[model samples]
Target: MSDVPPPWLPEDIDETFDPLEHADIEPSPETPLIVTPRGGDREVGRSCYQVDTQHGRYLVDCGLSQGTSDKFPDLRGLQPQSIDAVFLTHAHVDHCGGLPVLENRNLLADNAPVVTTPPTASIASLMLEDSLKIHRRETDGSSAVQQFTSRDVAEVCDRFHTVGYGGGRIEGVAPVSDVEPAIFQLGNTAHLLGSAWVVIQTSGYRVCFSGDLGGRATHLPDMSPPPESGLLMLESTYGDTHSHPSLSGARTGLWEDIERAIQTREPVLIPTFAIGRAQTILLIIAERLHTLSADLRDRVEIVLDGMAVEGTDIYHEYVEDTNYFAESLVNRVVESGETEPFFAESFTIPETDQDRQKILTRAARDGTVPVIISPSGMLTGGNSPRYLAEFTARFGNASVFLTGYQAANTTGRTLQSQYQADQETVSATIDATPFSTDWPESSDVQWVHAENTGDSELKTRISFSADWISLVEGLSGHAAQSGLLSFARTVAPDTIGLIHGPDYAQERLGPHLAENVAGVDQVTRSRRMTPIAVGSETDVDTAVISPEEIDSTGYTELEDQIDHLYELLSKLNEEVASARNEPGLSEAEIREVIQDEMEIKE
Candidate 1:
């Protein structure tokens, strides 16, 4: 629960400066809404935007881009003190990674709390703390010193005001002497844990911000639709193309790859992100294995390592207790007679050094293929590299399957490209080694085994050439072209401001939006840090229509159907209660009756 005031009425606001109700003071003239992109306009990373109106100045996001010399958002020529509020959509580094920098500079106003969902508040804290550790290691002696401390992350947590999606409105920035107070509401974007689509409303204007929107439902909830507004700020991560495979297809493909690896006794390495991607992969593996051959399924071991283990735990906690999912989905989970999905049967959470040693040793020695899913998907850092080094050398019985995007110039991308080149005996050398002797500059340290600890200083090497498979299915978090267009139609805003995409993506989407998307007057392809005029025609009807008002009958019918199902289930439960008194009734009979009543067949 956050201490921030819920939707403040005119009376609840400051008595000294009531912009809405003071008859004596004339309302401030509507200023042309100025949007300045400090980062993430034309580029794909470091997303930070400043939305300045006559009433308030708000920051949608502040983040750092990976694989760039200038990672942090450009904060020059901007006064952080002037900004009223910071709203974070999700916990991903590209969206919320630059918070520590802002905090370090004391840029945020004291009253302006970092506003976001509860899950995001928790996950962001974890991400920021982890980022701090990573930054400290990389920037130890470099000119780019680590900016914020662990204490800064703690302070961030303290300042977070957790609000649920589609809940009561939370006041963003307090109304100043003349500026009107901006009110904000969050809705699920289905991108990751606690990802949200935001709508901000002030007098005479409304704007919607789509922060990393997802199209289809995953293990998590489906994306909530953004309300129609005068101005829509949308993400175009995959707007250029619509070639992503379906979730079912991606799962089946990955399962087939794993099955082939198992048949050949080849160790399969699944490099993935610690959060959503890793958890989704685990569930997919667990569910798909029921159809697999008994021998192959029994032989496979799913080893969970690195930060993914922590992320999975967090996911389970929220999914079980909170409104993190749709009401219908939550009801289904409860009615299905299972509290949690069956994942523990195959997944292994190794705790100690000895436990990890057993997994690695068994993977190398046995005929059974171990599917090792490790973190740091890009191969820039984490346990995935260690596993890649260990297994990639054995070309005959090893495979590295990438399950996400590989950023350019990253070690993951390099490996992906090298594998595609069909070069024999490909070598990957790591600089750091356990042994501390000064080796010659020309010598490559070859790490034979993780446990092999001799006086010899050798670089970690992958001598054998193994072809790496890049699986894009179920990999990306952003919505594809079809999904984007669907969202655009649902919102039907007057103007669209596109950001968070490459040049080609925006180019393709801009034309599509102009011709096909109705009610859109203009589709602007945003560049870095350029102020665009929006909400100029404030009189235009841009207010979002309530769905209840339009489709009350359809909504009622759906509710009636759900109620009917519950009634049938309840009757089945009553039968079971009565059957308990009879000795002849069996468990199979009870289940059969329940399924029959529910119109389900095995």
Candidate 2:
């Protein structure tokens, strides 16, 4: 055999070499900070990043992916015992779902604490518990191995070290013994209640991790500006879009739709994320309840179901905390002596299957439109699907409003596709345990009773005639292209790495930032498992891949240009065809217009 050793092996090693034996390890000030994206690279879910510094190794976020093959972060080369701490930005599932997995796999070090804001810790507990239930239900009869257990979730929560926003220098979190700890600060991101963007200064390097920035939500304060850094890892979830629909306009449209549904006596089902979106929707409805006609307002009943009940309770728990909520919410809800800012006068929280059934039955019987808001925004889990199935089976004419991003392969995405296509009927198979009832033999729903199958749950296929299936825009927690560019400009980092977005979005955002943002020497679409080194004095390694160099030279730019040209051509063709149908348009005039357009293109 050759004398060369594997890359993983130590140089000049012999068989007698003890793995634990080592020379004195000293902190090197010149060591460049190495950031390796373990997840949330070129995709939206499972946001994780491994940072290796001179002082210690740390993780920015440990999260799980939904509706994708790779549900967990790439933990192949990660040693759980080596991680000093986990910096969680918020309580969203995609940003905190994998903490339990870390514990389950024995990856988390015994002394390593999960550092986050207090609001994040509280909401994350609820989110993790719900996630565990879904995980257990999904893996009930299958051979798929469970990623984590309830005990693991509890352990993860117990390890959380709550810190307030703008808190400088995290205490009791040193990466290496006897070395100076990293100085970090959390700024309000305005994405979720406790969301914050983390800026860490360690080993002579300042790195900023933009953990899901947001400024669109009216219930939360504007996102705080992050301090300048040498390296900025920013989320690009909406990088391909210029801007969102006006929040006021979206709210107006939603209220108008709800009013129309109420006027027609059709129940409206709104499937929303339990944490942020549900609370926002509730606030919107509550604020406008008085504006509705007295007769219509008296007939409208708001129903909050499933995990949203607990999620709202958590929101109320922190209602007075100015660090988490906006001044308007705190003043109007807490200072004004309002019992609850997120609930209408005629709101109901169904605690059991019987209550849920009664709500639907009463609504159908009395023809009083009930606006039902439930969790599992994607309709992938929770009681939303059960409600959806029951609604489809019970109501002939009803409205379903989807308020957030619906990932691919989800029932929400399926319904959204049908809605966009204006299909007369929408159909999908959903997993749920129906309320105790006996369906007629000629029912349209293909029901599989849990008792008949000896399982705890049933999967049923239900179809419904189109009745106002709407995808409400401007409710997203993520900032669009303009906001991202603005944030980048404010930070003005030398290098930027885009994460927590799809390939197309990152591809569009990477070059856009490089072209627009000044002082950005490099802009890259973060790739999972790739190591990017950032340091002031050190030369960037050749391993760092720029967005422009993702494919062949100038490929991304050319593709963007080609897409623009095609759009222009399509518009020109439409104009020419419309002119041809006009009474006075001639072939010569069309030729002139086409020639002028061609010259402009040249």
Give the 10-residue window scoring lowest on summed lDDT in candidate 2.
Answer: 18-27
What TM-score would you give candidate 1 relative to the actual structure?
0.77
Q: Which residues of candidate 2, in runs, are more than 4 Å off? A: 1-28, 68-70, 439-442, 448-458, 537-602
**Each model's lDDT:** 0.65, 0.76
Clashing pairs in 2: 80-107
Best by TM-score: 2
**All candidates: TM-score:** 0.77, 0.83
Q: Judge candidate 2 against the unseen true structure and give its global Cα lDDT, from 0 to 1.
A: 0.76
Question: Residue 448 error for model 1, in Å?
Answer: 14
Count of clashing pairs, candidate 1: 4
